[model samples]
Target: MKPVSRRTLDWIYSVLLLAVVLLSWGYVIYASTVAAQRQLRKEYPDKIFG
Candidate 1:
């Protein structure tokens, strides 16, 4: 068995961090779009479909 090097660990950590950040941003954008749609529907139900 061999221990992992510092550079490899840092690379892994950075990749994981970037993935988390990207996922978070994706979810935020999706949620905002859904909220906006809901608001528009609530405010103008007829106008939305037409």
Candidate 2:
């Protein structure tokens, strides 16, 4: 089998790095949304889906 080229390796690394960064941002957004929902529920016990 032929060895992998440097350029191909760089591209793969770049794609992986981008995926990690995107996932991190998504997690942060999800956590913030959950926290906000919890806070709303505490503040408005009678309201539904606010």
Candidate 3:
């Protein structure tokens, strides 16, 4: 097998960084939505419906 080139390594690193950023953003949004739901439930305990 041949040695990997610097450019290829850079590309792989960039893709990994992008994936991490996107995943973090998604997690933040999901967490915020969950927090909002919890707050809503707390403020309106009797109004939650399935």
- Where model 2 places Cα greater than 4 Å from the true spot, the runs are none
Q: Between prediction 1 and prediction 3, which has the larger TM-score?
A: 1
Poorest 10 consecutive residues by lDDT, candidate 2: 41-50
Please list the C-alpha lDDT of all candidates, in the order they appear: 0.92, 0.95, 0.94
- Which candidate tops lDDT? 2
Compared with the true structure, the alpha-carbon lDDT of candidate 1 equals: 0.92
Ten contiguous residues minimizing lDDT sum, candidate 1: 41-50
lDDT (Cα, tens digit) per residue for candidate 3, span 18-42: 9999999999999999999999899
After superposition, candidate 3 runs with Cα above 4 Å error: none
Give per-model TM-scores.
Answer: 0.90, 0.91, 0.88
Clashing pairs counted in every model: 0, 0, 0
- The deviation in Å at residue 34 for candidate 2 is 0.5
Indicate whether candidate 1 or candidate 2 has the larger TM-score. 2
- Candidate 1 residue pairs in clash (backbone atoms < 3 Å): none
Better of 1 and 3 by lDDT: 3
Candidate 1 residue-wise lDDT at 14: 100
> Candidate 2 lDDT, tens digit per residue, 1-50?
89999999999999999999999999999999999999999999899864
